[model samples]
Target chain A: MYVIVSGAGSLGSALAASLVAAGHEVFVIDPDAALLARAQEDLGSVGRAGYASSVAVLTEAGAARAQIFVAVTPSDEENLAACQLAKRVLQTPRTVALANQPDNVRLFETVGVDAVVSKIDVLIANLAGSLPAHPLLKLMPVAAGSREVVGIKIPALSVAVGRAVREISLPYGSMVILVVSADGKVQTGQPDTVLQAEDEVIAVAPADAAETLWEALTELR
Target chain B: MNVIIAGAGRAGAALAARLAEGGHRVTVIDPDRRTFDALPRPRIDSGEITVIEGDGASNDVLEKAGIQEAGLFIAVAEQDVRNGLLAQKAKLIYRVKRVICSVKDEYLSAIYRGAGIETVNPAQMEIEQVMAMLGGV
Candidate 1:
C-alpha cells in the first residue's frame, strides 16, 4: 500500500515503521525536522520526508497516489485541516485524522474525514497491556480482536528447552518459530537445535494462547 | 564523523551501505564471519568502510574498531534489551557521543528511554503505519 502519514510524532513514526516493514511504499509528512530525521533513520529505504500540510509538499510526496492518507499530528485542528487538504486539494480517496482531544472526534467525522481516532479511545484499550496481543498494534485495542505472534527468550529452565519442537506440548493452535537469535545472529530454524538459555525465539501462536504459551514454556521451571 | 556499527545484521548492513555511499568511514563489527560473505566487502572498502568480524559488545572489539574516537555508535543487533544496554554502555562505559539502538517492541521502546538511550522500534513503527493504511487514520 502507498501511504502518506502527516505527523512524525510517536504515532506517526510508529505507523511509518510498521508499513515500511510490511513492504509498503510510505511517505511521511511532518512539520518537525527532528521527527522526520528520526523517522528516516528508523525506516531507512522506505521513508520520504515532507511537510504534508502544504499542497506542494503533498503533491510532491505523491499524495494523489496514496491509498491512505493519515493526519496524526498532535493538534486535532491541524489533523483535521490536513485531512481537508488531502481530500480537497490532493483528491486522496481515504483520509483519517487523529483527534488528540475526544471532543474533536465527532467534528472530524462530520467534516467528512474517513475516520477519526480519539486519544481517549486509544488509551483505554491500550491500558489492557496484554503482551503479544498484536505485534503491530502494540498499544492499540485491536490486539484483543486480532491474532498475535510474539518473540520470547527461551529461559533455560522452561519445559520447552529440552524437547523437540514438535514433541513439545503446546496450547491448541498452529505454531511456527520464525527466527531464533543466538549468539547475536538470526537463524530461521534448526529442528535439532536445542533452545538454549539466552536464545531469543520469535514464536507464532494464537493471540489467546499468549498466557497459556507463556505458562507452558515456563512450567517446567 | 567516523562511525562503527556493532553488528552487521540487516539494519547494520543497510546502514553501512548508506553511510558508505554518503562518504563516511564505516566499520562493522560482528562475530559471525559469514556476515562478511553477505556484505559487499570490495564496495564498502572502496567507499572507505571497513568490516571486522568480532563481538562488538566486547571492549576489545570496540577498541580495535577505533571506538575511542568514533563520534557515532549504532547497535543494530538482534536483541532490543541488549541494544539499550549497549547504548548505555557506549555512553557511560565507552563514552561514545552519539548512540542509537534498534528495538522491536513498542512498550520496551518507551521503557528503554529511561536508561538515557535512544531507540528505534521498527515493529512499532510498522504497526503505526499499517494502522494508518488499513484504517485510513
Candidate 2:
C-alpha cells in the first residue's frame, strides 16, 4: 500500500519505519528538514520538507495516489488540515490524524478524517485504568472512533464473576472476542464459557456502550 | 448576536470592539494576556466586551468564551492552520451559525474555503486591492 505520512516527529518516524518494514511504499513530509532527513534514513530518500497541507507538497509526495494519508504533527490544526486536503482535494482513500486536543476528536472524526488518534485520550485512559471509574481500557478505536476494542477486567467482587459469558448482557454492537485468564492463558470467548475473577476480557464495542458494558460486568446485581 | 473572536491581536481586538459597539456580546480569546492590550480598555472594563487569556484553538477556551450560545465565531490567530481548525470546530462542533477564518496564505484559505468554511485571505485581499488600484488590469 502507498502511504503518505505528514510530520517526521517521533510518532511519524516510527510509523513510517513500521510501514516501510511492512513493505508499504511510504513518503514523509515535515517542515523540519533535519527531522525529515533523520526519518528518511530509516525509510528511504522519499521525504519532503514542507507542510503536508500544501497542495504542491502533497502533489509532489503523490498524495493523490496514496492509499493512506496519516498526519501526526504536533499541531492538531495542521494534522486536520493536511488530512482534509489529502482526503478532499487529493481524494486519498483514508486520512488519519493525531488529534492533539481531546476535544478535537469529535470534530476531526465528524469532518471526515478516516481515523483519529488522540494521545490525550490514550494517556487518560491509561491512567484511568487503575481508577475505579474507568473499568474498561480502550485498546483501539475503529470506524473513525465510533467503535473501539476495550479490555474489561472482571473484578473479584463483580456480579458477573462465575456466571456464563452468555448470561452477561453485553450491549448492542459489543461482543467478547477473547478472554485472558489470571494464569495468562488466552482463549476465544465462547458463549457458554463461565466468567472468572481476574479474567481480562477483550471486547469489541461501540464507543458509547463502554460504560454500560463495564457496569454490567463489574457492578453488583 | 453573541460573537467569539479567537485571538486578541489588532484585528481581533478591533473587531471585538466594533462588534461590541454594534451591541453584539463579544468575547476575545487569546493565549497571551499582553495581546489583550490591543483591545480598548473601556470596552473590557465596562463588560461591553470580554477577554479570555487562553489558547483560542482549545475547546475549553472556546467554551469559556461562550461558544455554546455564540452566533458568530472569528479566528484571527497568528497561525493559518490554527485559525482554520478553530473555525471548523466552532462551526461543526459548537454549531455556530457563522464562522470566518482569517488565513494569510491564499492556498490554505482556498483549501479551507473548499471545505465549506468561510475564509478571508488578507494576502489575496491585498492583491485584489492593488489590482483594483491598477484599474481593471
Candidate 3:
C-alpha cells in the first residue's frame, strides 16, 4: 500500500518508519526541512518540505496515487485541513487525523475524516487504568463511539458477590458479556451464571452508562 | 443583537468594536487574555463588550460566552480547524441563527461553505481586491 504521512514530527516519523519496514511505499510531508531530511534519511521514503494542506505539496507527495493519508501534526486545524485536501481534492481512499484535543475527535468525524485518533483520550484512559481504586477500566470504544467495552473486578464485600447474573438489574443499555472467575475459569455470561468474588467481568454498555453499570456491579449489600 | 466572537485578534477585536458601537452586545473569547488589549476601548461603558479568556472550541467556553443566546457567532481564530469546529458547534450544537468563520486557506473555506457554514477568505479577498485595483474586473 502507498501511504502519505503529513507532519514528519516524532509521531509521524515513527509511523513512517514502521510503514516502510512493512514493505509499504511511504511519503512524508512537513514544513520543517530538517525533519523531512531526517525522515528521508532514516525511513528511505520520499519527503516533501512544505505545508501539507497545499495542493502543490500534496501532489508532489503523490497523494492522488496514495492509498492512505495520515495527518499527525500538532495543530488540529492543519491536520484536518490536510486530511480534507487529501480526501476531497486528491481523492485518497482513506484519511486519518490525529486530534490533539479530545473534543476535536467528533468534529473531525463530522467533517468526513475517515478516522481520528485522540491522544488526550488515550492519556485519560491510561490515567484511569493507573488509579489504585478505579472500579471500571475502559477497554475500548466500539460501535462507532456509541458503546464501550469495559472490565470490572467484583470485590468480595460487594452486594453482587453471590448473586446470579439475572438477579442484578443492569442499567438500561448495559449487559455483561463475559465473566472470568478468580480460579481462571472463563464463561459466557448467562441468566444462571452466578457472580463470584474477585471475578473479572467484561461487559459492553452505552458510553454514557458506564458509571451506572460499574456502581451496580460494586455496590455494597 | 447578541454576538459571540471566538477570537480577540485583530479581526475579531475590530469586528467586536464595530458591533459594540452599533449598540449590540458583543462577547469576545480567546485563550489568551492579553489579546484583548488589541480591541478598541468601549465607548458605551454599558458592558456592551465582554472579554473571556478560554478556548473557543470548548463547549463550556461557548456556553459561558452565552452562545446559546447568541444571534451571531463568528470564529476568527488563527487556526482554521479550530474556527471550523467552533463554527460547527455554534450552528449545530447551540443552534445559533448564523455562524461564520475566517479561513486562511481557500480550500478550507470551500469545504466550510460546502458544509453549509459561511466563510470569509482573507487571502481570496486580497486577490480579488488586487484584481479590481488593476481594473481586471
TM-score of each: 0.37, 0.74, 0.72
Which lDDT tens digits does candidate 3 get at residues A1-221?
99999988889999999999999999999999998999899987888899888878898899999999999988887888889889998899999999998767877888789989998866765664555543589999999989999999987656798999889989888889999998999999897899998899999999999989999888754
Clashing pairs in 2: none
Q: For candidate 3, report its TM-score.
A: 0.72
Candidate 1 lDDT by residue in tens digits, B1-137: 88988778888888988887787888888888777666777776575888887756556777889888988989888776446545655766667878888877444454445545678887878889999889875
Off by over 4 Å in 3: A124-221, B43-45, B79-82, B130-137
DockQ values for all predictions? Answer: 0.01, 0.60, 0.42
Error of 3 at A193 (Å): 8.7
Query: In candidate 2, which residue ranges exceed 4 Å CA deviation?
Result: A124-221, B104-116
Chain A of candidate 3 compared with the true chain A, TM-score: 0.61
How many clashes (backbone N, Cα, C below 3 Å) per candidate?
A: 9, 0, 0
Candidate 3 lDDT over residue span B1-137, tens digit each = 99999988889999999999888999999999999888766542568888889888777788888988899999998877678778876776678888898888777778778877899987788989999999966
Comparing 2 and 3 on DockQ, the stronger one: 2
Rank order (by TM-score, best first):
2, 3, 1
**Residue-level lDDT tens digits of model 2 in A31-136:** 9999999999877849899999888899999999999999999989889889988887789999999988887899899889999999886666566455574257
Candidates by lDDT, descending order: 2, 3, 1
